[model samples]
Target: MDPSILSGMRGFGVATIPRWPWFVFLAGGMGCLACSSLSHLLACHSKDFNLFFWRLDYAGISLMIVCSFFAPIYYAFFCNPYSRLFYLASISLLGVLAIIALLAPSLSTPRFRPLRATLFLSMGFSGVIPAAHAVILYWGQPHIFVALGYELAMAILYATGAGFYVSRIPERWKPGAFDIAGQSHQIFHVFVVLGALAHSVATLVILDFRLRLPTCAD
Candidate 1:
């Protein structure tokens, strides 16, 4: 058992688990939202601004996907330092690669919308690896199972959002009716926000389970 894990355990009135993982996740979420808002707000300013802000928004999405791994991976592998480090490092590297791939201006074009969404969806779905591992690691724990359920929901929500993004639904059906409002892009953002909330609930559930454990040895 790691001494740090034991140290993080505390009695009432004190935090019972380390908070940095949650903070990392939250910061990533906020950064993504900010970039998204800026892209939507200023992309209309000019062609140059459009390209720049949209690219930043894509990069922010990658960052959030990477950071989303921290809380669950850290808590589930609390006493397994090597596994924790390996999973975290793997996701971080993948995120960097994703950002590098998206940096190509060619990928930002309308013709590549599906490609962009596919790249992001691939990054998001990669969570399945660590998620499956976590389930295997804590197979007997009901709370872990509950957390996994929420994670599954998050995955569905994100996939649905990506579908909306790539297919350009309702808006496509109505054409000019959705020009000013209710665009597919806007709907995609809403699903993303919902997905993030679902992920937050999963992380909190995992954190609570970890706190209740008397010791990492358990």
Candidate 2:
């Protein structure tokens, strides 16, 4: 915590930071992974069911990505009220559009896999603008660099996953070789989980830094 805040707390303690953004992220993460696992497990039942569950999985992914934006954006722009509101509103609108497209049966099809991947990539990489802004605003803060390293790692992992998903890798190179193992889809899931872990670490770093400062001082 901020030395001033912590010292003040020593006499009259208070924890005033709102935690809704982080909580939303945790819920979204759980829902995304659960839906993905369930869809994979039950997709073999029938083609219709396969489509439905897969679409649900896509929706879950969208939810997680969108929710993940909240905490970072909130903490990053916390003191800059107008910027915070603008970023949040923009992402919320983009997320709505992304969810609508992902839930569409045609857009969710294998034939449109690249399109879906691009949409996700677009949403993810859009953070570049805000990250750049943050760096410019806090160039002397070492904690910002630490958090940025983790965020970059997340981006790489996620991009790798999207590549595997779009290319239908190892499986596509030798179809039957991966019949029971090493499917591109499985690899994609692995990378996504790894990416999320990286992001969570970054979030923790940022949270720790933010918690140490007075709320309106940044």
Q: Which candidate wins on lDDT?
A: 1
Residue 159's lDDT within candidate 1 is 89
Clashing pairs in 2: 1-212, 2-212
Residue 217 of candidate 2: its Cα lDDT?
Answer: 51
Mind giving the per-residue lDDT tens digits that candidate 2 earns over 1-218? 47686667643223555678888889989999999989989988999999999998988888888888888888777778888888888888898899999889987678888999998898889889888888887798988899999999999999999999999999888879997889998999999999999999888887777766665653
Estimate the TM-score of every prediction: 0.91, 0.92
lDDT tens digits by residue: candidate 1, 1-218: 36665555454312546889999999999999999888989999999998888898899899899999999899988878889999999899989998987877888888999888888888888888888888898889999899989999999999899899999998879889999888889888889999999999999999888877665553
Candidate 1, superposed: residue stretches over 4 Å from native: 1-16
Q: What lDDT score belongs to each candidate, Candidate 1 first?
A: 0.87, 0.86
Q: Write down the worst ten-residue block by lDDT for model 1.
A: 7-16
